[model samples]
Target: MSGQRWDMGKDTLSTLAKKTGGNTQDLGGLVKRLAAAAQPLEGKLQGAGHDAFIAFKGRVDSIANDLNAGLAAIAKGQSGMDAATRTGESDMAQAAKKAEGAANFDGAKFTKR
Candidate 1:
């Protein structure tokens, strides 16, 4: 059983080395190559992140513009409402004065000279 285990371990190591295309001692070289390959990807990721930030900023600006437009519309509507209310109040006051004048004329006619 021990001999079989030893043979199995050796076979496993050799198979692993063959599959990896190199010996285990070449791990450092493989890591360096992998790092070299990853550097360009890292730069690309940074550029993508920058682009995403710009897009996000553009969206924020658009939202801010929309909010400003909404506020301006609200202000205009409020001014219109205020003007209408003032006009209505003026009309009511004029009507009250006319009614008062009519009442005074009626009272004067009912009284003696």
Candidate 2:
């Protein structure tokens, strides 16, 4: 048996982090387009015997508004996640640099003077 271990959680996290921004934008755009397309249908349903149709159109408008709000919330959450990820990456790099510097300093101090 080959000694290869697969870490699925790490791979999933990396893929999600890479795609979060693009996916969020695409979803937001689709929601906005859906909302826009629904707007004209509201006007087209204006007739005397179409009360139910009018009511349904109103409900559709409400749903579109809610979807847009949800999209905004998703975007805000993605922004926060991106900032946190960048900060985490920077902290890890800084820690690695400090550890490397300390390792070199200790070697030099032990061998010289």
Candidate 3:
């Protein structure tokens, strides 16, 4: 009878020890479930980031294109203005030469003398 009681005590203690010892498979399963639960949120965040990146890239491209076009317009305007100024200067120089030729050597024909 004492032997049977001793065996029962040993069995109870062994069962308790085995229960307290953590199982690797259970822990792994729990980790997998937690990861699975977070997958949707991760995917959503990725999608949002991708959308924002595309929008930002498009905006930057648009701004760059507009800036280039504006610069080209400014260059064309400056070129036109430079051509006009050159033409005006040439005309003024020709008029001055003609006036100088019309004047006499002593500057008395057209002047008061």
Candidate 4:
């Protein structure tokens, strides 16, 4: 009985070792194939990232240019408004001086009451 039990134990251990060895070989082959498959994808991902960065930089530049143009327009409009205000003030001052002179004149001499 002891001999039979020992033989069975030895056979089971041998079978387990054979299966473990085969599985290890298969795992190594799978790892190699996975690495090969991922190589091209890694390069493609890097290229995609670079392209996206360039596109993003272009967009940022365009936005900055547009903002600068808008600011320039706003500055031009502000200068124009300042000029118009100064002209209006000058005209008002002249009108007020004329009214003052007219008030000092005797209206009774120019009209028969």
Candidate 5:
């Protein structure tokens, strides 16, 4: 009666949440390290070069911010799925049994499953 299914458990959700948090922290640390490592070189650049570098760093930081937000959303959804599993949400449980790959996800329409 099914072609495919997706299954997840509390342990998987918990581990994913933990890993996502760690990744967020690591990303922040990496950004900080990049800033620290670049401080020494900023002085070497002059005028346009320094301005360009600054803009690039700003863009990178912005992308990282977006990435962190997406990760957080995914982690939150995972937790919701876990809750649904625990509380016996039939729809969520049924969907879990037939979930398929999403071609596009913006993390903007996330709802408690």
Candidate 6:
């Protein structure tokens, strides 16, 4: 006997996608709150302080925009992967069922002809 065996575990890609998508949602909410909080600070400073704040704020705003876009892309990718995994799992299930019906192994041994 070769003693070869196969063990296929449950699919977890969809679970990972859900978790990653949830993280993006949480981060997106925080980004929104940050932008809102930054609004009232505009025009409240003077001189170099104001210049520095303005410059940094501009850069932060740009970065926030990019971050949101990237997070949105991540969410989209997660959704797509989740869907693909689900479909792939269904196909695997059907195939397994078909294979089981045609299986040649008995409960205790292989019945090779």
Predicted structure with the largest TM-score when compared to the true one: 6
The segments of candidate 5 whose C-alpha lies over 4 angstroms from its true place after superposition are 1-10, 46-48, 56-67, 88-113
Q: What is the C-alpha RMSD of each candidate to the true structure, in Å?
A: 34.3, 8.4, 39.2, 38.0, 16.3, 8.5
The per-model lDDT (C-alpha) reads 0.54, 0.60, 0.55, 0.56, 0.70, 0.70
Collision pairs in model 2? none
After superposition, the stretches of candidate 2 with alpha carbons farther than 4 Å from their true spots are 1-52, 104-113
Q: Per-residue lDDT of 10-101 in model 4, one digit per residue for the tens? A: 24444544455445445545545554565565445657776664454446545545555554555556556556666777899999999998
| Per-residue accuracy of model 2 over 1-113 as CA lDDT, tens digit each | 23333443324344554566346556656655665677666667657636765565456645655665665666567556667777787899999999887785655565545
lDDT, candidate 2, at 104:
55
State every prediction's TM-score relative to the real structure: 0.44, 0.49, 0.45, 0.44, 0.52, 0.52
On a 0 to 100 scale, what is the lDDT of residue 71 in model 4?
49
Clashing pairs in 6: none
For model 3, which pairs clash? none
List candidate 6 segments past 4 Å from native.
1-49, 59-61, 105-113
Model 2 residue 99 CA deviation (Å) reads 0.8
Location of the lowest summed lDDT over 10 successive residues in candidate 1: 16-25
The number of clashing residue pairs in model 1 is: 0
- Candidate 3 error regions (>4 Å): 1-54, 107-113
Prediction 5 global C-alpha lDDT: 0.70
For residues 1-113, could you state the per-residue lDDT of candidate 5 as single tens digits? 13322435446666767788668657756775677688788879999999988886777677667767777787788678766666776777767766644434566577888
Clash count list over all predictions? 0, 0, 0, 0, 0, 0
TM-score between candidate 1 and the true structure? 0.44
lDDT of 1 by residue, 1-113 (tens): 77856663324443433434333324444444554555455445657776665454446545545555554555556556556666777899999999887785655566557
Order of candidates by lDDT, top first?
Answer: 5, 6, 2, 4, 3, 1
Better of 2 and 6 by lDDT: 6
Of the two candidates 1 and 4, the one with more favorable lDDT, higher being better, is 4
Backbone clashes in model 5, listed as residue pairs? none
Model 6 lDDT tens row, 1-113:
23422322344555555667667656756766775787677678789988876776667656666777787787678668767777898999999999999987667686769
